[model samples]
Target: MENNTIIKTSLDPRSTFDKYEKRPLINAVTTESYEPKPQAHNSKIIIESIIHGFDNFRKFSRFYAFMGLVAGSFFSSLLAVDNLSQLFPTFFNGYLQYIVPHFFMHLYIVGLNQLADLEIDKINKPYLPLAYGEFSFTNGVITVASFLFLSFGSAWMIGSKPSLWSLLVTFVLMTAYSINLPFLRWKKSTTLTVMAHAIGMTTSFNIAAFMHMKTFVLKKATTYPRSLFLATVVMAIFFAVVAMAKVFWFCVSLLEIAYGAAILIGASSPFLWSKLFTT
Candidate 1:
C-alpha cells in the first residue's frame, strides 16, 4: 500500500515542484485547531480596580469630607471680609480677629464632629475609612494635631488682642466648647448647638466690627461715626434673624414639613424632596 501511494506521482502545471526541478514538498501537519490564550493579567484592569477602591473609600468617608468642608467654610468666612468692607464702607478692618476665630472654630468643629460621631460611627458609619480601621489611630492623631497647631499658630501670628491672655482665653473657649467631656457638651445638645451657632455668628460680625473699630481707633477718628451706626444696627438685626432661622430650621423644620405634607397629600408621602427645605 505504501508503494502504491508513492508510485502514482504526476507533474501538474499548477505545482511549484514541477517548475522547480521536481523537488519534493512536505505536507502540512493538522491535528486540531488551536487558539492562543490571553495574558494572565491586564494592566488596565489592575489600574481600574485601584481607582475604584479609592472612589469607594471616598464615598464611605463623608464625615472626613465634612471636616474638610468646615475648614473651607472658615476660609470662605475669612475672604468674606473683603466683601463685608464693600457692604459697609465705614467697616473697620479686624483682619486677624475674624480670620483667627474662624480657623479655630473650624478646627474644633471637625474634631468635635469626629468625637460626636464616635458612637454613631461605630454603628452607622463603620464602613467609613476614618471611622473604620483603615487609617491608623496615629494617623488620625497626626491629622488633628496638624490642624490644631496650624490654627493656634496662625492665631498667635495675627491675633489683634494685644494680650496673649486674650488669645489663650479664646483658644480655651473654643477647645472647651469642642472637647471637654462633661462640663460643656456643646455638640450633643440641640440647644447647645444652636447657641454655639449664634455665638459663631456673633463672633463673625463682631470680628468685622472689631476690624473697623480698630482702624478708626488707629486713625484717631471721632467717636463711632454715626453714618455707619444704622448699618451696624441693621446688620446685627439681620444676624439675629439669621441665627433664629438657623435654630428653627435645625430643630423642628423637618417635622414641620412632614406635617405640612400630611395635610396637603397623605401620611404615607415620602419626605425626600421636602427635606431640602430644612437643609
Candidate 2:
C-alpha cells in the first residue's frame, strides 16, 4: 500500500508544480487590471510645465546681453545730455527711469525671435530651450506677448518720448524680421537681415539722443541744437555702412567711429560745448 502511494505521488508531482506556478501569474494579471492609469494632462502638470518654460526662456535669452544693450542705450543717452563729469552725479537717477522700459523692450524682441525660430532652432541649435522641449510653445507666446504689452505701457507711462518711439519701432521692425507672416519675414534674405539690423541700430542710437535731450536738455534749453542731429545722422550712416559689411572687423570699426563722432560732435556744438565747459 505504501509503495502504491509513492508511485501515485511521483506521477502527479508535475500537476502540483504547475498549480503553484499559475497562482502568481493569475495574481499579477488581477492586480494589473485593478491598477489606475496615469492622467495624461492635468492642472498641476500644466502649471509646473509653464513654470519650467519661464525658466528656460530666461536662460535662452541670455540675461546679460539684455543688460549690456540697456546699459549702452542709457549711457549713450546720458552722454548726449551731458559731459562725462556731469553725468556721474545724475547717472543713477536717470538709469532708474529708463531701465524698466528698456528691459521689457529687449525681452519682447528676444522672446519673439525665439518663438518664431523654434523650428529652425531644432535643426541649427537644438540646445535652445524651446527647441529642446524645455519650454512649451504656448507659454513662450504668452510670455512674449506680456513683455510686448508691458514695454509699450511702461514707456508710455514714463512719458519718455524717445523710449516710447524706440520701443514701438524696435517691436515693429523686429516683428517683421522674425515673424513668419506672409511677405514679412525679412530674416530669410541676407540683405534684408542686414538692413533690418542697421535700421534697428540707427533708431536705437536716435532713441538715446532723444532720451538725453528729454531728460536733461529740453527744460533748460530753448532750441534743440542742429549739431546733435547732424551727429546722430552721421553715426547712423556709419553704423549702417559697417553693419552692411557684416564682418567682425567692421563692427570694431563702427565702435571707433562712434567714439570719434561723439567726441567731435560734443566738442564742436556750441550748446553741448557750453554745457560741458561752463558747468
Candidate 3:
C-alpha cells in the first residue's frame, strides 16, 4: 500500500507540472498573435507610399525636354533657309548643293553635353534614367544614332547643294566639339571658349538658312526681303543676353559657361517664320 501511494504522488506531481506548462504555452501563443491593429495598418501605408513614389519618378524624366530642344533647333533653321538666301544672294549659286547635311549639326551639341557631364551626371543625377540603371549606354548610342541618321538622311534626300555642305560642316563641328573641345579645355578656357561657342551658335542660324535656300553664298542683293534676317539677329542677341544672364542667376563654372553659350547660341538658330509674324 505504501509503494502504491508513493507512485500515485509522483504521478500526481507530473500531471500538475504538465498542466502548468500548458497554461504558459497557451498564453504565449495568444500574446504573440495579439499585435496592435494600427501596426498592420501603418505597414500598408508604407507599401502604398513606395508604389506611388515610383509612379511619380517616371513622370519626371527630362529626356523629353532635351529631345524637343534638339528637334526644335533643326526645324527652326529649315524655316529660315529661304529668307537667308535673300540676305546672302550668291549663297545658293556657289554653295546651294551642300546644305543637305546641315540638319544633323544639332546632334553635335547634344552629344557634347552628354559626353562632358557623364561623370557629374552619374552623381548629381542619380535619378536620371541612365544613372538609375534603367537606361543602358547602348540605348543612348541608339538614340543619338537614330537622330543623326534621320537628320542626315533627310538632308541627303533633299539633294540641295547648300544642305549637303551644311551637313558636312555640322558633322565636322560635332566631331571637333566631341574630340577637341576637351583638348581646348573649353570648360577651363572660359572667355575664349565661350566666344568660339558663340560663333558656332551664330553660324547654326546660317546653316538653317542653307537648308531653306539649298545654298550657302548670298547673291549681290542690296537688301534681303525677308524680315527673318531681323528675327535671326534678335534671337542671336537674346541668346547672348541669356548666356551672360547665367552669371547673375547661378554660379559660373567651366561647364556652365560652355553650355550656357551653347544653349543661347543654338537657341538663336531656330526662329523660323519670323517674317510671317513681322508682316
Write one digit per residue (lDDT tens) for candidate 3, span 113-212. 4545566768987655455555466765675576678667876665555554545554554455444454653444445444544445445554345334
Reference-based lDDT, residue 69, model 3: 34
Model 1 Cα lDDT, one tens digit per residue, 4-119: 65555443445545556543232223333354445535666778889977875454334453443334333433333334544343332343343454455354445545554556
For 39-142, candidate 2 gives per-residue lDDT tens digits of 64566688898898677766777697675466456545554554565456565556656667767878888878888989988999888787888779998898
Clashing pairs in 2: none
RMSD of each: 12.5, 8.9, 12.9
Model 2 has an lDDT value of: 0.69
Error of 3 at 36 (Å): 31
- Report the C-alpha displacement of residue 123, candidate 3, in angstroms: 2.5
Residue 17 C-alpha lDDT in model 1:
58
TM-score of each: 0.44, 0.62, 0.45
In order of lDDT, best first, we have: 2, 3, 1
What lDDT score belongs to each candidate, Candidate 1 first?
0.47, 0.69, 0.51
